[model samples]
Target: MKKVILTALMSCIFQFSNAQNDIRIGGMLAYGTEVENIGIGVNAEFPIIEKLTVSPSFIYYLPKKVSGVSINWFEFNGNANYYFLDEGNINVYGQAGLNYTNVRLSYDGAYSGFLSSAASDGRLGLNLGGGANFQMGGNILPFAELKYVIIDEGQLVLAAGVKFNL
Candidate 1:
């Protein structure tokens, strides 16, 4: 089941990247509760049309320790965004996409089998968000975004980074 899902996601990523005017690479640094610590995410967007873009991203969170248990996670998401206003250095847009979350765990110090617990799981996520692009120079712009993902407990991510128009 997991293999099938991952395979499908990989297929979509390749197909999307090969498709129109988009920012090729971008990333963000942020702090959040749901992430349990500091996190970083980077994404690449391929424009499918004038107003539509396809984005694939990867996010990683720092490990959090609790009761001798440490946990960390990373996920890959493929998203679509529509730019309502793509003018000057300011661009406002709405986005949505399918996200695949792969959660992993690592134990620092050991204990009983039941006491030291770890598991690998995956989930399907939905993303809804918006952002602003501030032109920094000619082909480079710094941007800030607020994104929310619907998963088990709902994850909210606030990120800012530089995007290069391609």
Candidate 2:
């Protein structure tokens, strides 16, 4: 099931990129309020029309140790952005999307070999947010975004990154 989902996501990414000549790819530095930790993400943007785009991103939160347990978290988001303001050096947009959040655990010390459904959680959610992009001198564009994912407990995420136009 997981394989099928991943395959379809990848296929969509490729097809989107192929259809758009101005696709952009980038790495993001992200912060998740639920995890209370910093993370890294990779994202791609495919412009569909003059004022709209499709963006897909994956974020991996760094593991945190809590009482001999290591918790790992990640998220996959498929979003759409509408650029209502795309003038001059700045582009501002609103975004809405779907989110998938997953968490796993690693036990250490006395907690070794312990496994339970409680140690892992995966959920599908919804995302709503807005962002702005700053066009630099050339192909590099810097951007910042804030989003809320309505999932099991809900989370607020902040991300900033630079995208290179392809």
lDDT of each: 0.77, 0.90
In candidate 2, position 97 carries an lDDT of 98
Instruction: Find the 10 residues in a row with the least total lDDT in model 1.
Output: 108-117
Native-referenced Cα lDDT, model 1: 0.77
| Model 2 worst lDDT window (10 residues) | 109-118
Tens digit of per-residue lDDT, candidate 1, span 1-166: 9999999888777766655344568787755557667778888877775578787888887777776667777777788888899787688888899878777776634455554557888899998898777876777768887788889997887778877777
In model 1, residue pairs whose N, Cα or C atoms come closer than 3 Å (at least 3 residues apart or on different chains), thus clashing, are 20-47
Q: What is the lDDT of residue 22 in candidate 1?
A: 49
Give me the displacement of residue 89 in model 1, in angstroms: 2.1
Residue-level lDDT of model 2, residues 1-166, one tens digit each, is 9999999888878866666876899999999999999999999998876678999999999889887768999999999999999789999999999999999986755445655333687999999999999988788989999999999889999999999898
Question: Which residue runs does candidate 2 get wrong by more than 4 Å?
Answer: 1-19, 109-118
TM-score, predicted candidate 1 vs. hidden true structure: 0.77
TM per candidate comes to 0.77, 0.82
- TM-score, candidate 2, is 0.82
